[model samples]
Target chain A: MDEKFAAIGEAMPRLLDGLVVTIELTIFGAIAAFILAVILGLAAASPAKGFRIPARVVIEFFRGTSLVVQVFWLFFVLPLLGIDLHPMLVGVMALGLNYGAYSAEVVRGSIQAVPTGQWEATTALSLGPIQRMRRIIFPQAWALMIPSLSSLLVHLMKGTAIVGFITLADLTYQLEQVKRTAGTLFTYGVVGILSYFVFALVLMYFMNALEHQAKHKLGQGKSLWRILSPAPPASTPAGGAS
Target chain B: MIGISAAFEWHWSAAAEVLPTLLTQFVKVTLLVTVLGTVIASILGLVIAMAIRVLPRPLSEAVKWIANVIRMTPIIIQLLFASYAFLSLDLITIGVIVYGIHYATYMSEVYRAGIDSVPKGQWEATTALSMSTLRTWTAIIIPQALRATIPALGNYAISMFKDTPYLLVIGVVDMVNAARIYGGDTYRYTEAFTLVGIIFLLASYPTSLLIGRLEKRLAYKT
Candidate 1:
């Protein structure tokens, strides 16, 4: 027990470093994925076959293949094509493209889920396609997609573990190192999984708050402040004035 | 750049030589793990969902917490941990079991959602008829729940299939591992990884389309 505690103490800094990398990968990859999702999703939902077809093909190709293969291909094969990238870049790009494809479906679905009456209202108001999206359509769809997107974000964070395979010392890799030193799989395994679980809980809390705020803005739900505070049912019932 | 290009080129001959090896490994390891894992996950997940439903509240909450922790953790880490902890077991066996249990967490949620989708009326009707508990579950609830769950289960199976490569950490020599070995031997990563990607796309694309269709059909029935 003493030896194991000593080993854990030695492993702490390295594990912290790995956690930072994992967090960085998740954040950057999410930004890139969100951008691609919006673009490709809009294109997929477009009436124009030219835009929709290409977007569909891109999404399918990325979605159909395994992400590890994508990461390996980028890391191993791209250098031969005179496009050498940093390992971090490779990790972020692979994650971005792969999860981007999945999130694109979420985006398209949420957009489609928006009431046709809203679209009709925009059309009746002589709103252009861009205006219809920006002013009325996107805000509603944004709220609808948040729950799905939040889950995807958690999955993406879990997926960051694969970056360790590509020689990036992400949290999983660091934990493996600790496991080797400690010679106790159960201890480190518990620590590793607990860390990830805590991270996921934090991410989910943030996403839920974001979802509540988005819905509240649309006058559909209680404010985030209210949700966070202790409920006084008699004082302010649901949908009641603040 | 010029030097690297000279050193690395896609070889049809290399690909042809490795194709048989990859395919053999794909069948022996990758597909085997996926099939067995899916079976284990499906049955185990249903059991978990039912357990949570029938058990006392505190016990069910404990089960739910365990499931969430497993679901949130990375499969690669789980694979590594299992491999280390179970030194007596075959690496492939460990891989399948770990994958099954890990994914069973996600599948349990799907099962729960499916079971919840079965109407309260159905359960009340079963009670009214004085049907045995097993009869109520097996005859009515499970069948209706399964219809809603099948497509989602199919998606998770495909996901499990793709994740078989994570077993490489435990030296499972799955399709991706075979490709990696071939790449190391021939110093031709381009063909091996690209071929692996193509193989994955080929296998999973059709399955996803089929699932999409299945989902639509199931939705109509529900």
Candidate 2:
């Protein structure tokens, strides 16, 4: 047990390095995913078949296939076609494309969930298509989609474990290294999972704050300040001014 | 690296040669794990959902906490932990159980949502009729919840099927692993990995379509 603790102590710097890589992959991948999701989602929700068809094809193809295969294809096969990308890039691309496809559905659903009254109101105001979506539909939809997007973001973080397969030393890979040196699966495994759980909790808390802020903007939920502060008495009404 | 001319070629013959090996592994490992895992997940998830509803507050909270931790962490690490911890168990068994339990957490959320969707009136109706707790669940609550849950459960099964490739970490020789093995031997990765992707698309796309249809039908009925 003492040796195991020492081993873990020795492994801390390397584990921290791996955690940094994992965080980088997740952040980059999320940016890529968010961009693709909005584009594909808007396309899918468009009135034109021209826009919708290709978006559907991209979304479905990516959604249907496994990420492991996609990552491997980019890593192993793309080079054969004379388009070699760094493994980190491949990992990000695969993660982004896969989760982006899933998030596209969430985007489309939330946009459609916005009431028809809002659409008619936009039309009544003579708002152009881009203006209507930008000024009205998207903001409402954005608030609605944040909760689902939060879950997907967490899923995307967990999905970063796949990077280890392609030889990126992410947190999971580092934990495996720690296991080898620490010579105990139970301790390292518990630590490995706890670290991820902690990261996930932090992410959830952040997303929850974001969600609260969005809802607060739309006049639906409590102020961010109220939510962050100490809880009030049980008899106090929600959204009341402090 | 070998020249693009030699490496990038898509030979139908190489694909055909690799197909049988990958397909065999797909049936033996991938499909088997999915079927068993889904079964385990479906049953366990319902139990968990019910336990959360009925168990005392602290105990239910504990269960929920465990489930969230399991759900939030990557399945790959869970597979690794299970494989390492249970050395006596074969990797395939560990794969199924780990996949099952990992997914059960997600499915429990689905089940919980479904159960919550059961109208309060139904519970009130059961109580008014003096129905036993088992009968209230069996005849009133579960039937309604299951209808709402089936399509979502199908989606999770498909998700699990795509995820079975992660079993490669535990040396399970799943379809992707079989393809990787074939590619390792022949140095022809494009055909094998592409075929695996195609196989996944073929298998999952139609099922997702069916699930979409089922979702629509269920919505109509409700």
Candidate 3:
């Protein structure tokens, strides 16, 4: 027991280095996913069949495959095309691209969840497409996306472990090194516990903050959900449910 | 170790030599694991979801917290912790316990959502009829819940297949590990690793297509 505790103390600096990589990956991944997903979401929600179908295809393709496969492909196959990127770049790019695809639908769905009346209002006022989105759609759309987006961030943080697979010295990789040197179960637990500590803290913090922001934003306007004809409460009255 | 040299020139001869065993035994192990993992995951997941049903609001919330805790942890780490942590302690039971527990959390959420989507009125109707709760859940709630959840269960199955690689770390010698051995043996990473991923796609793609169809059917039904 004491050995484990002491090993954690000794392992702190190296793990902290690993933690830095994890955080950097998480932050970059979240930002890239957010930006790309916004574009993806916009493309998906577009009226043009040309735009929407391809975007939907990209979204499902990435969403369907294992993320580790994507990372490996980028790390290995891209160099065959002379893209010879750094390992960190490869790891980050893979995660961002893969996750961006999934988040796109989430973004598109949330934005579309806004009532048709809101779109009609913008159209009636002669608002351009961008203006309609920026002013009318985004503010309310953000509220809907917040809960899911918060969840996605947590997943993104966890995804940093895939970096370890790419031979990057991320938290999981660091833990493996620590385990080899320390050879103790306690040290392994410490690694899980520490990473979990950082993850849970960031996750809960982001979620709560978003919850606060969502409440504040939605508190002001009469909701689009309200204006869209509300469904009856309780599926108990549900019909034709086999 | 197969060493570094044989890994580069990965030969058909090597893969071909392994083919007889690969075709039969690998398929048996793969199917065994996929089925076992899915069944155990479904059962455990339902139990966890039922806890949400029976538990008080605060307790359900606690269950959600536990679920997130599991969800946030990587499958690889959990597998390692299972094989090493428990095995070292002479607790082999803990390995299955870890997989079942971790996967169960996600599975439970699937069940919870399905159960939640079941009209609240169904429960009230059962109460109105003075029917036993178990009978009501069995006859009504779960049937609907299972339908609602089949796509999700299919997802779990695919995920479990991909996750077999984690077992390699625990000395389970699944396909990924098998390829690694081939890569090491013949100095041929290109073929072995590529084949392993192809095998994964072969399984995952069809399973995913099935899920997409199931989702469409459910959406149409609703």
Candidate 4:
């Protein structure tokens, strides 16, 4: 136990460096995914086949295939055609496109989950497509999208470990180096998984806060903590009202 | 000539040479890993979901945390660790187990969602009938839960199919590994990698479409 603790202590600084890379990839990749998801997702939800077909093609191609292969393609194959991207750029692009495809479905589903009456009401208001989305439908859909997006954020955090495979010196790569030097898989593996778990917990907390705010904006109820707490009978009353 | 070859060249002949090896590995290794992984994952997930639902709160929460740790870590790292630690199993078996456990966390969530979707009335009906706990689950609840879960299970199977290439890191000699080896030998990286991508697309795209249709049908049924 003492030896294991000592090994972990020695490995901490290097692992922290890799953790920074992992966090950077998650943030940048998630931002890219979010932007692309909304665009592709809205394109998918469009009534026009011209808008929908290309979006479907892109989404399916990325989602259906393996992300590791895509990373390798970007890293190895692209340069053969004279497009030499930095390793970080390659990592971000691969993750963004891959997770973007999956999250696009989440975005499309949440948008579709909005009540039909809302769309009809918006249409009755003589709103254009952009106005209908921006002013009316999207705000409600944003709340609906939060929980699913939170899970995707967790998945994206895990997926950042793949960047280490492409030589990004991310946490997983650092852990592998520690394993090599320390010659103890158990010690390093536990530390590596715990650090990832911590990263995931941080992400979940942020997403939960976002969900809280989104729900508040949607007028679902009070803040998440208050809503989670049990209420007094006189204050809460019965569930008689919609 | 330099512009055309350097910019992009198909090398159909080289691709043709590599096809036999790629196809053999595709069926025997890639598909096998996916099938084994999905089977193990589905069973493990169902077991975990049941455990979480049945166990006492504190114990269940501990199980949940363990599952979350498994879920949040990358499969490549898990594969590497398993390859190192579980030396008794062959590399491919280790690959399958690691993939199964990694995705089992996702699958458990799906199962949990399905179980949660079971109507309260159904639970009350089972209780009212004084059904044994085992009987209540087996007869009343699990059938309904599994009906809702099958489509999602199929979706994850498709996902596991794509993720099989990560087995290469553990020296599983999966199709992607085979492709890399072929590419290295022939110096035809483009043909080898592109063919591998094409093969993955061919298998997964059609299956994904089928899964999409399955999801639609399931949704309509519900």
Give the TM-scores of the predictions, in the order they appear. Answer: 0.96, 0.95, 0.80, 0.92
Query: Scoring each candidate complex against the real one, what DockQ results?
Result: 0.67, 0.63, 0.19, 0.49
Model 3: residues >4 Å from true position, as ranges? Answer: A180-183, A220-242, B1-32, B55-65, B88-99, B162-164, B171-173, B176-202, B219-222
What TM-score does model 2 achieve against the real structure?
A: 0.95
Residue A118 C-alpha lDDT in model 4: 96
lDDT of 1 by residue, A1-242 (tens): 67877887888899899999999999999999999999999999988999999999999999988988998889888887888999999999998999999999999999999999999999999999999999999999999999999988988998898887778998888887787667747545777888888999999999999999999999988889889888634555679766
Scanning candidate 1 chain B in windows of ten residues, the lowest lDDT window is B1-10
- TM-score of the second chain in candidate 1: 0.97
Residue pairs with backbone atoms closer than 3 Å in model 4 (clashes): none
Candidate maximizing lDDT: 2
TM-scores, chain A, per candidate: 0.92, 0.92, 0.85, 0.90
Q: Quick one: ranking by TM-score, best first?
A: 1, 2, 4, 3
lDDT of 1 at B40: 95
Chain B TM-scores per candidate, in order, are 0.97, 0.97, 0.83, 0.95
Considering the two chains of model 2, state its CAPRI-style docking category: medium
Candidate 4 CAPRI classification by DockQ: medium
Instruction: Give all candidates' CA lDDT scores.
Output: 0.90, 0.92, 0.72, 0.85
Highest DockQ among the candidates is held by which one? 1
Between prediction 1 and prediction 4, the one with superior lDDT is 1
Off by over 4 Å in 2: A229-242, B1-4
With candidate 1 superimposed using the best TM-score fit, by how many Å does residue A231's alpha carbon deviate from the native? Answer: 8.7
Question: Looking at candidate 2, what is the lDDT of residue B77?
Answer: 88
Cα lDDT of model 3 by residue, A1-242, tens digit: 57766776788898889888888888888888888899899999999999999998777666655566567666654554445688888877867887898789789999999999999999999999999999889888988887778767776776677677667888777887788656646555556755765675777687766666665666753334433446734434547552
What lDDT tens digits, residue by residue, belong to model 4 across residues B155-189? 89988888888787677888888887886687677
lDDT of 1 at A204: 94
